[model samples]
Target chain A: MRSMYKSSLIACIVLISVLASYSFAMAAKKVELVVWDLQGYSDQQWYKNANKAFMEKHPNIKLEFEPHEGVPARPKFISAVRTGNAPDVGILNLYWVKDFAMNGWIQPLDPLIEPETRADFFDGFLDYASYDGKLYGLFTETGVATVLYRKDLFAEAGINPPKLLEAWDFEEFAEAAKKLTKDVDGDGKIDIWGIGISGSRTGGGGPTTFTQFPFFWALGGELIDEDGWPAFNSEAGLASLQLYHDLVYKHGVSPRESYSYTWDDIARGFSAGQYAMALLHNTHAPNMDKQFPGQVGAMLYPVPEHGITSATTAGGWIYSILTDDPAKQQAAWEYVSWMLSPEVMKSMCADIGGLPTRRSVFDDTMFASDWNQVFGRQLEGAHMKPGDPIFPLIQDEFAVAIQEVMMNQKDPATALDDAERNVVQRAKATDILK
Target chain B: MERKSGSLKQGWPYILMILPTFLLLGLVTFYPALYNIWLSFRNESLRTTVSSFVGLANYRRVLSDPFFWGALGRTVIYMIASLVLRVVLGLALALVLNIPQRGRSVARTAILLPWVLSEIIVTAMWLWILDHRTGLLNGLLATVKLGPYGWLVYPGMAMGTIVMVSLWKNLAFSFLLLFAALQQIPLDLYDSGKIDGCSSGGLIRYITLPLIRPTVTIVTIMVSISAFGQFSLVYSLTGGGPLRSTELVGLYMYQQAFNFLDIGYGAAIAMVIFLINIALSLVYYYALRSESLY
Candidate 1:
């Protein structure tokens, strides 16, 4: 019995040493970086290819991916941040960057971007990522709004495409819409609509806001002054709203159903030949191309009458690092730098249907051939929203104004007046008027 | 003194038996409630780990905010509409089901089907059925030469649609309770009422209502509580859209806490909601208690 006990103790000692050595060996292997995002659409195994190549170069490192839907992702990410369990890297909208940066949730990335590499990115792209004179995130892609139309339906109506459709004023746009609204099959009810502009709750609020900006900008209506005081109550602003109100109520070219359409609905409605035109984001076009072949074409938003140039809103997703761990931060910086490489960006734009934020990527022959040129065209005239803590509140107020006017809850003049007053009051209370 | 000491010794075993339940209750319920109350005083944000105490500022902001009042008012309206409809409809159906008829069991099962289905699935089904263009409701209306109407988009109709969904999903519990109450109504009372020349309406108005008043009151309270805290149906259906017409307190709280990452403000709103619900329930209980006494 003594001998048996001695043998068992020796075996136990051996097991412990072996387990310790195994754990040490495993720990010595390269660290894995986690990138969490919600953009889940994968085209023809492109991300898989990118991952394979990336892994081959960094054989010791691994990429961990977590995809989530929009509604649940917010809560999950907030919980993760609250518990100090955020991923090493994340993809978030540009509007979210300021909020995250102001709260110090994300790290400043200026130190990560070497001087030599800074020249590779577009200036506008770089500017969008910087806040308070510090870079906190890098834009993976840029998106701009455009009007997508069905070529077949346009041809069927015997209506020639408007000359410089991308630069047409409001009156020109309305005229084209009216010409396109005919019942081709002689059905008393209208089967095809002239335009599909979303005023609905489910619709992409960004695009709705984007689609409205040109009118305001063209009329020289400013949301804020040089010192950032509320300035949207100007005459130009009211005129812009008057046009939006007229688009739905007076001209009657846009569909009545548009009040409930989201980005997906508008895209799907256009693809299904229900509407002739849609105020759409460039990112949605590639997917629509796949879903409905050779049916759609895109143009930059129309210029406003008496405006110097056409304007559209430019927005996109950015990669933000959420950790302060030196090792993880180093790994994340490497991943981010690699992801922003011109070749990698081209692949991402092609694979994920996002626009490349770098101007150099526009030279790729693939963009011209792959129908991504629309993003290039739209980005040339895109505008960035003023980054502020009050931006989301402003967005909400703007959306409310749109609903009020579109739903006929109030007249255009009254709605704009109310919005201007409310925004001013909110700004005063929040000390944002400065 | 000897007997009292013996009783104290016996009480120790009972305490030991109740200890686990008390521990579980404290761990799960009491701890979070206390923690949340503490959190409401701090400027906790999703962006940072460090938080500072802001005292009643969160409550001040929440109370003064227009959206809060809008959501609260909408929630009250929704609660009243859904509670009334659920109780009335559930009682009517239970009364019908209590009659001696063929396939009564099958009918009861069919009526409870919506309650058994997942809330998300039920919301999705209603979403399709309420779609302005391709919805079954609109389609049927069109076939009958009635004009198609927007069921979910129109602001006046949005709350009605939500109330309908809440009623459909929650009425089954009330029905079951009322069915049991009906079965316990003592058949001889109805026979005596008939001999006294009481009409069916008079019998139900007097005998049935008075007898089942307590069960009905309980059902009303339960339905009111459920409706007051509605989250899933509104979230899935409208997302508080078309200009925040359908925004409920639960959704507003969620947006404030999760989307805006303002936990302190969110918590303040939550506490306010909790207080209001307690007050409302107490008032309801008192009114019922008085009615029962009379």
Candidate 2:
């Protein structure tokens, strides 16, 4: 009887110890979170530092940051979401939020964002983020398009630094381009082109589309209806395209080669003195400043008429929490909120040479000064592309139509008609017709 | 042993032997192919949560797409242009390298370097070479005072450059095959040709060319099929650009499926590509049969 009792006590003690250790092991395991970003290899160091800072605060969370190679990120992001393999957080072009949200691949961020937190972001940015009356993302970095010029080129051409809001419409812009365009070496070919606006995928052909498209928008031309149906065919739209044609074909102000230029191509060409003026963005301004030192100047995109109210396109990257886990969601928001805080936001923008999307950050003396001053003023007129599910497809069709017209594959009227029809059909198919 | 019954002893081992490969094929290929076919007949969109059968609509849409046609034509052009050049150039190089000469092994190894380099690196290098404003080609042309010609900016030139780059990256396989074929020609046969008053050209024509024709045909068909599916080099280099001039059906289908989130349309395009490859293969088989080369 004594031996039996003793053995039973030993077995019970051993079972209890085993269960306790197993429970402890389970409790101690760190929560693993994945984030997909397009920050690229060059920016990997910054991410590492930021991630390290994040990890130190939250010891139980392990964050994995994966950077995509290039433009393929869009497709990769879409595929991951569809296959239910999307990361806990996704950083992408702000334009993608609508498409992702529309597809129901992403959760509405309203549950994560509070009204007080929402108020901290710039109103224009918030407006851009909200689609169909729901908040889906947090905007990061300001992407305002500006006119970057070589001060040396301006001085050499005997042209004064451009004054504010002065309408340098089509003709004036062309004249400046002609005066600045010089072969210099008598090589019988253009050694220095006038202006660099990509007709290529570098900017998604955006320079031509963005810098030129705004003129049409300023003139009251619209590409799609409020319902995301086709609407670009108009007399005003042709007039907009004609301006581009005249610039490349007739005036020879813009480089015909811009059609093949990429984003880096435009900036590098400018750095190499291949072009006098580049309708570039603040995103690229820091590099321009570094490359040319004091030779860089900035202004709003040239207005249609010198005095016309210039409307800049609101663009930027967005960060969104991609998780169903409440703890991970809270942790991701912590990172976002920390990043968006005025102190952090100002420092990042100053370091990266972009605009801060937070309105509160504008009060910072560093942000209130020269370079940031330019960015702040530009942000006012900046507008966002419509946050419609069909927007990306619409943008692609718009680009194709513009290229076709510019390359003389189709007349403007016919090109617009075809684009309009394709877009409507696509929208209908996607059930966005209503 | 009495005749083996239909028993576990007889059947179990056969099942075990074939099971692994069968499972792997099912896992890797068969399932995905069936899924894609199923996706083709469904209405898939980023907006909708539900997938519904849309039947032939996706196929009709793909057939009517101008971008699809443009991309298909470009793919065919790239396929034919690259394959023909690869075959001719590869054969010529193989013949030259096959000569009894010093450092022939080194020559063969050196020629294969471009083919061995990673595709991304090759693409980055070519992009530097063809950059419009500050590329090496433009700079060299400037030295001759010939032109600041926009090599990559020009639509036609851009497509040609992409094809050329692709050919450079893949031509080594053709060269190796042809070289092997040349080496396989019996030494005794060449000696006989030499004895029969065969000069260098005559020897190649009568003995070398006819004998290697089989290898040449095989390489042509293989290269053509590979080039028809060409996507990466073009995607990396031109991105089917300067006005979508270099767009291939592969890139288009990719964009449709992934970027546009139109899986049904994308799958339709893939099926079209499949049909095209099948048709090309059939035509090639017919050509081979008519010549009775096999």
DockQ score for model 2 = 0.42
Candidate 2's TM-score: 0.88
lDDT (C-alpha, whole model) for all candidates: 0.76, 0.75
lDDT digits (tens) for residues B1-294 of candidate 2: 455665767898998999999999999999988888888888875445577999998888888777788898888888889988999999999999999999998988888999899999999998888776678988898787766666666787888888788877888999999999999998898899889888999989888888888787788778878887888887888777867788898888887776666777788888888888888877876675436432
DockQ of 1: 0.37
lDDT of 1 at A121: 76
TM-score of each candidate?
0.87, 0.88
TM-score of chain A of 1: 0.84
lDDT of 1: 0.76
| Residues B25-115 of candidate 1: C-alpha lDDT, one tens digit per residue | 9999999899889989987765455788888987888879887999999999998888788888999999999899999999999889998
Which stretches in model 2 have alpha-carbon errors above 4 Å? A1-32, A41-46, A68-71, A111-114, A164-167, A201-208, A408-411, A425-434, B1-26, B197-202, B289-294
